[model samples]
Target: MRLRDYLRINVWLLPIILILLPITLIIFGSSYLSTPNTYFNTQLNDGWSVSHGDNHYENVNLKNFNLGNTSKGDVVTITSTIPDMTAPAAAIMFRSILSTVTVWIDDEQVYEYGKDFADKNLMLPKHYNFISIPESAIGKTITITFDVTENNAFSGISPVYYGNLFELERSYLQSKRLDLFIGIFLCLFGFMLLTLSSYLYMYHGQDLSLIFSSVISFNLGAYILCYNDLFNFIGDNDFYFCIMEYVTLYSIPFSIIVFLVSTHPELNTNLAKVFLSINILFPALTLILQLTNLVHINYFVTALHIMALLEAAILLPRLVMNIYRRYQSRKNSPDYTGMTSDSILIIGLVVFIFCCVIDIAKYNFFNEFGGGGVAYTGITFMNLGALGFVMSLFVFYFYHGIEHINAAYVKEHLEGLAYTDPLTGLMNRAKCMQYMATVKGNYALISIDMDNLKPVNDTLGHLEGDRMIRCFSDILKQAFDGASLIGRTGGDEFLVAIENPESGICEKMIEKLETLMAVFNDADKKIRLSASCGFAYSNEPKLTDANSVFIMADTRMYRIKEQHHEDKLSKFLDDIISGKISQKGGEEGT
Candidate 1:
């Protein structure tokens, strides 16, 4: 295949390669290099004990070797022997923890986390920490102990890994690269959508759907970033992190539902409103609670996720039903096309829903697998679905807009043709009548009849007669610069209307017409142009409308024509008697 054809076929792969492929490779490559070694996997589940507040560590061997939920001010100490690995640094990776921890190596405090302002805000996100093993401690027994003062989830500690610090950090990045990419991808993509939407709204037409989709994208990006462990390297403000986490998580579904409603406004039913309220109200309540330190997010994460899943389940089917009904109605219509954005949206939602289900399972049921190798979860699926759906909807919006613009252009052109005079390029009689019927206020009318038009056609051919009419139309337009309407009313007849005409405007127009006729006659000696003109103003009580003004003007025009004919007859008699000119044929008398 040609390069163009190949690219066209694989266009969707571009984003995946650009945004996600590098992270995937890093995950697998690091996992391969960091497979468990004998020294790194040394067992530390035994010889552990616990004590209450303000107590030094004690060695109590427990049957169940797990750090169960530790209350505030509770301390946990684990005594373990470190093998002589002779490594530069040792590290401990916590699969999941909700407590502040302090680690000591051989009576020396190596690292302490989660202490701020006398341990008032002491929650720490799950992460890996490094402990430097000094050269003095190698080949000697080292005491490792940590205190877990608080926790909200898994109230106890699960298995921890003692490994090379470099290898552990590499593994940590590999597992986090997916979420990191997703967070960055969402932020960047949302910004792009906002820019595109602004351009479209300004230039093409306003599409609220683009705006809503951008909102969803930004909300979900923030939601993922709040959970990203990389933030640990940035700050230790647990309260801010917790508030952002809950707030952003709550906003995601609410924004998505809002986007759906914007796309299909017809679906703004009571049921949708209820779903919206749930999505918005719960998160908002949760955010308030977190801000006040009234509740921990772990208390409501499962319920909120269930709400998100339910919202998706309900909203998708309603969307499908709406599309089905619309399709049925349009199937018999002329311009009907097949499935629309709704179908593509359903597919995207399904992808998103599937990923969500998997993530719920990963976080709730099979939670042990986290902080290990990279696991495919909702983040991947959500990104896939959001990109597909938003892109499809954008294309649809532009497509519909283009179709409407083209249709309007065609209609406007047809209307122009209907109301225009073909030969003279002036308004046709139809337009003139319509204008007169709709116009308000005082107006003036002029009725003009071309003189000797039939004689010109007979003597100089029909082409010259047409040229005379065009020249007459141009002079009429130029003379009546501000006329409300001008048209070729009939063969050899023209009419003009001017609104609120001053007393002198009509006399000035007639004088101007005579001047233009004299000028044209002087130049075009072969085809002289002249016409009988009559004018009337409608400001008086007797002439109440434009039609009445036109009738009076037309009557005056015929009377003027008769007077011109009588004058001509007398002039002919004088010319015959004086022998200055000769009348030729019966045509001259006629």
Candidate 2:
């Protein structure tokens, strides 16, 4: 009904709208945009023949072509007729994995790769083979030979493309634009998370979950870029990028485990620790073996898949159980709120694991049944799943951060209320005693007592007395602006403690107090402001601690107060005797 209430109720919708509006517009606008079509290139998916050691297949479908079984050093030869091409610069393009390739256009050699790697006993990395076709080669039979370099590596062949070289490359990159955007976005997001988490850890002592999340995000992003061969834009070193791909991939599970454990310590079970240890060891061992030429990292794909499945088997159930228990325990409580960050995290984890299962299943399924190809031209479900998981982690991190900040704010506010005097905002008596009881080092304690407080209360009311006390407290604050401590110790009683006071500093503060009081009294005629103050340094003889110094200061302050009283009485009597002032109702002049 009210504007404030409406705003309060709908404030959360603002971010949702801001996020969804752009997405909706993009979805809507995309329908009107022209669809991408091949202008200068064509996919050659049919009319291919394959020959492998005593076996020959005719009219094989190149799009889903595969050799049922293959061994290291096995050779598979494929031949296809190049269609008519009008483009001046022509080429045949396809991707190869873990294989050395040689291309011949009607017996004239046109392209070769991985011969050096094979000679050196190194793994051949996956690469896009773009063989330039001579203008005279049109209508000629194009023969390609794949020398499989690893067991189980020759799963299937990528669909061949023939046309203008640059256009084919452009189309290829254009198809990968979404994946590129996501990969780069994720890397940048991870860097931003690292920066923010580092600051929070240094200043606020936050946990390492944010750091782990950042690592996971960066690794996943790198893995995406490398696995898709998009990182070739940055560098043409396919071998190093292949290593990076596996390294980043193997590193992810460890960071994920660490992040989960950091966020939910309850998840740090023995099984999780074992998984963490294996995740740590697997990558290092694999990398060492690869570098030593004992075994290539590509051969460990099945092992990594098994490890992931095992981890998910142990973690997913426990995570779901943990979320269930937490929700059940808190559901009926008055403070209950639906869907905690942990719940969101579990959901994200489930979705991520699901996507991984799909990818893994697809890989195995196609290898067994659908001609052994696992490449998707556009963004994969794994990428979308990873993005969702990372977003969930961001939500979890920020939710807890905001919760911590709110808790700290409430604690500080409560502490302020407990220690501070409501009227003058000075330290209360309890806080003063607490400070004095534990105070260390050399210091001077000044005891201050306001004069004529009771008389002001009797004549002008307690409100005026309170005003006088506040005025005196302000004077004390101004006099000892940066003093160690100032407090209202009792009614009309105040104390100022200065640590390591300079020579004559105590006297100077007392003089300043008197001057401020004089100025305050001159400005206001309602009540004369006066206070007797005496300070004793801790270095004074026989002053063992703050309490002793305080006692000495109080004693000296009483002596000053007695002198003021005596002087006031004498002045009043002098005035009365000289007929300058008169007593009212036989009362003594104050």
Candidate 3:
């Protein structure tokens, strides 16, 4: 097989290894009783009796026992004899799926977990249970009875082990290491998702997919915290633990669906809505049952699990169809390349389904795979599956976020191009009109016309004319860089809107223009540059239209151009008359 195929197989094998390795070490490492001589240590799997809800059984081994959605109260009794009289102390270590447990040794109370049956308040750690053996009970027959009650968990009972006190303690701590490792990994991963979500929100306008992905991650982390019994360290409220589990479990499907919709937007379906409604409805019903004490929540959880399976069955086919349709569409399109979102989502869902199927099989068909009845196989697969789904979702969110940002950038650049003039790189007339139509308050509009642009183009070349227009545009931008708007209104006409300019600034601007023209004419003897400019401002509180002011300024500019034409004509007549007088004088001299 190729390396990638090997990697995939390895990933599937990892969870099984994680579960089995620690359990094997704990079981074998603590198998021998700690003593100066040879001693006997036993796992109390046989000769157990269980009674719950009018049902009774005898000689029930851990493998033969099943909880079966029973979450309220149960009793388990184990009768065993110490084979070695020389052994000093025997201790029992076991993990319990029950929320509350009370133990008695030969009718003498040994350990108590909670106050009473209905006192669903304090919760003992599910990772390990260590019960110390008294020195007085040496060489005696021990009858151990366990009073157990559970909440929303489907896990039934853990096998009991008897060994030396020191050996049992070591085994208890060793067994907890795996759960600790998984919990820490999940918590850190969830925190990373939260951090990424914040960055996406700030930079990418808070994409709903990323936000929902973060929520899903946090919910998963919290669920793991409760499931692995880490929450007992913070607080031992059984009711709160159950409620947290309910909330997290109820929110996961909705959050994932929301994330999916927000990422694709095309995959929104009635089935997703139905799944969301089922998730919400069941949790609310469970809460009502909790409040009314009508039924055990485990039965409700069983129903929810069935509904989840149905949802997965329905959702998986629809998702597959969506992937096929999207793939076909992209295959015909020119721009399609690389892995698509639907493809990634399908991979994730497939992995999740595989893991869930394994878990279901483990829970039903092969419950005694590892000899010890911890049911770690199913739980391990479930957690790994959830993590796989979460990682895939993160991948989707990352790509989706990038696509959104790129699209926004392209749109903004296109808009910038649309409002810009091609020749002069200035605002076009459309932009000018838009600015005039929306602006308020005091503003001055300057209308400018090239005086000799047509003559320059006709006598010289259109290139020179364009250069003149460009020069005028540059000068206008430099003078009115902070103006409200500056744009090319016509071929040789430019407009500028000065925001809140003083009355004297306009006159000073006109003087500056004249000075610049004189300098240009002196430096470039081949061409003379000049322009006629007019400006107007209205500070009236009820100004009707700023474009009207622009019209007035344009009219005034035309009037100035007409006056310059008349002045040039008069100068030409004077020069002609002077030449005639000089000619007449020269003729008299001859």
Q: Best-fitting candidate, measured by TM-score?
A: 2
TM-score of 1: 0.65
Question: In order, what is each prediction's RMSD in angstroms?
Answer: 8.1, 4.3, 8.0
Question: What do the candidate models score in CA lDDT, each in turn?
Answer: 0.67, 0.82, 0.66
Q: Give the top-scoring candidate (lDDT).
A: 2
Q: Could you tell which candidate, 1 or 2, scores higher by TM-score? A: 2
By TM-score, highest first, what's the ranking?
2, 3, 1
Candidate 2 lDDT tens digits, 355-401: 88888888777776675355432237788788878877877765555
- Give the per-residue lDDT of model 1 (tens digit) for 256-351: 788888878888999999988888788778767756666655567768878877777777888888878876875554333333446556665666
Model 3 spans with C-alpha error above 4 angstroms:
1-74, 80-91, 98-100, 118-128, 134-142, 148-156, 161-207, 267-272, 316-346, 364-374, 434-445, 483-485, 497-528, 536-542, 559-590
**Residue pairs in collision within model 2:** none
lDDT of 2 at 445: 92
For model 1, the local distance difference test gives 0.67
C-alpha TM-score for every candidate: 0.65, 0.85, 0.72
